[model samples]
Every structure is written in structure tokens, then in C-alpha cells.
Target: MAGHKIPHFQNDAGHSAIEIGVKEFMCVGANPPFDHPHEFLDMGAETEKVCPYCSTLYKFNPALAETETVPAGCTLTTEAA
Candidate 1:
């Protein structure tokens, strides 16, 4: 009896799978969409500071004592914290 050699399989699905894995494994941290700020600034608001990178709002209180400069273009308004 003689053994037959099988050829390697090639398909678009395999290429797509490899591409997706590479993209997912890539270190694309803080690249886009979820832009993380390097420095946090306190706007002196009642208890919240707006993130400049992602434009997401954050809150700080007197208990934490975490003071940071508020980003530019943000208004400081005092409220009960």
C-alpha cells in the first residue's frame, strides 16, 4: 500500500481569522474612541471634572481629597457635594 500526501488548505476564511487575531492582539491602548487622558484636571466644580480626551464626566468629593485642575473651556460651578 502507498500513502498519499495531502496539500495544504488555503481559503479566505483562514486569512480573515489571522487578520482578526492580529488586530485583537495588537496593543492599541488609548488609541481612539476610548481616548484616555494622560493627566486628570480638576475644574473646581462642585464634585465633578470633565475628561478632555473622551469628554466623559467624572466626580470627586471632599472625602477623597483628590484635587486636580479643571480642563480649559469648562465652567466651575459650586454645588452640594
Candidate 2:
């Protein structure tokens, strides 16, 4: 993201996955006191989305098991990892 101050959701592997069914979400660079304008993000068939306002990139992973945010390859989200 531009300026690198833009905040994004990330797993322990530094790769973040958007959960299924939660297609629409809000993108804010920071919280409360330092928050930017709330940008609405739509996760379509594409795997990645970027917020125009904050330049934050949001990724959708089909392998997230429908109930998780982290990818299947993520160690932090699985027991067998």
C-alpha cells in the first residue's frame, strides 16, 4: 500500500485470506483516532482486491474452508500445521 501506513489483515505467514460468504467488508487504514475513510470492498470471483483510498490489498482464498480467514497452508490456523 502507498506510504506503507495503510493497514491490512495478515496471517502469521504474512498472507491474508478473506473468508467465504463475507463478500462485502470495510477497509480502514487505521482505527478510531487514526482511522481513514471507510472504504467498501467487494470480493468477487477474483482472488485479490485493492482499496482505492488506502491502497490496502485484500485477498480471497478458496481454500479457507468456508469458516476461516487464514489459508490452508497457514500454520497458525490449522491443528496439523
lDDT of 1 by residue, 14-74 (tens): 1111101000011111333533334324334344444344444444333322122122212
Q: Which lDDT tens digits does candidate 2 get at residues 1-81? A: 123222233233333333432444555544445456666566767767876755655666555543345443322211110
lDDT of each: 0.26, 0.46
Which residue pairs come into collision in candidate 2? none
What ranges in model 1 sit over 4 Å off? 1-37, 65-81
| Each prediction's number of clashing residue pairs | 5, 0
Measured by lDDT, the strongest candidate is 2
